[model samples]
Target: MMRYTLNKMLLRLQNRYNYDVRYQQDLLQTDLAAFLKFMAFQSMSSHQGNLAAAPLYAARLRAIIFEDCGPCTQLVVNMALEAGVSAAMLRAIIEHDLHQLPEDIALVVQFTELVLAHQPQADLLREKIMALWGSKGLMAIGFAISSYRVYPALKYALGYGKTCSRIQLNDASLVPNRAAVVAAEAQNVE
Candidate 1:
């Protein structure tokens, strides 16, 4: 059950996005001011695109998967499919097979994983991204990854997030092995 009335603007945005807004509903009910602020921030941040749609979507999906934010991951998977990212690519990401992606997109996913994990290599990955896409492009990628973090945090904090969604449940191994990835990166660094 929702805790507050849906304002006209928010309702319109929800309709347009067609996203499940259970987290937003909880936020709105608990704190209208914060909800409005978050919406405004999202609106402005969403337009700061520097990466191409496909790679950007791939990076976001990677981050969502790393976070184990099931509902959010499902939402991103849907958006990626709608935006023409191949099902094969999405499956590879879900399965943690970064090598299956094209080189550039694979790099983006790797970078996103490092960022989400707060690995030291994140700095090196940023340098690689800058070399490929320049400063603004790096910023755009960072923003894209950062933006997706908010929803999962909100959902978890509000006690609404699940460990895994139905889509992720299709394969029990869909969950990423973050520790293994980090350890491998560390070995490479050493």
Candidate 2:
């Protein structure tokens, strides 16, 4: 039997995922095998260059949202914003207004949602993605969406999850109801 300390586990997670994993760190405390398996899945899904960053971020955001992992959702949002995704686009995604995004990103989001929901449209969407991004790209997208599903289930089942909330990005804060904030700003300007 092997024992893993919290510090070592946190360091490993930070190195691999590049973010805090404290939200589900108890998985390490209780089931090291499950925790390592989740980490491995994440690593496998993290292959780069198969798809554009923007569309990949959009798909990942949709996946985390569908999985209902509040902390994970906020983390991805912050990461995307930091990686140069426009705040407006992130807001649109959070609101499920895919029409506001570019066609490719919108398609990726729609595909992610359908796949996460196990809807029949997922197959058709997969075909479209294959056409647009080729087989390698489609495979990467599928890996990302499916692998991201692991965290929310683990977090929720282990009593480590919460409802999504505002997240900070760079020096700015990302609120859940950004539309309301924009409306308020407009009224103030009038």
**Which number leads on lDDT?**
1
Worst 10 residues of 1 by lDDT: 168-177
> Candidate 1 at 38: error in angstroms?
1.5
Task: Please give the RMSD of candidate 1 to the true structure.
Answer: 3.9
Per-residue error (Å), model 1, residue 186: 3.8
How many residue pairs clash in all the candidates, one count each? Answer: 0, 0
Model 1 Cα lDDT, one tens digit per residue, 122-183: 78778878998898888788877887887787688888877755454234335544447655
Candidate 1 segments whose C-alpha is farther than 4 A from its true place: 1-19, 166-179, 188-190
Cα lDDT for residue 145, candidate 1: 82
Let me know the TM-score candidate 2 reaches against the reference structure: 0.74
The local distance difference test score of each candidate is 0.71, 0.69
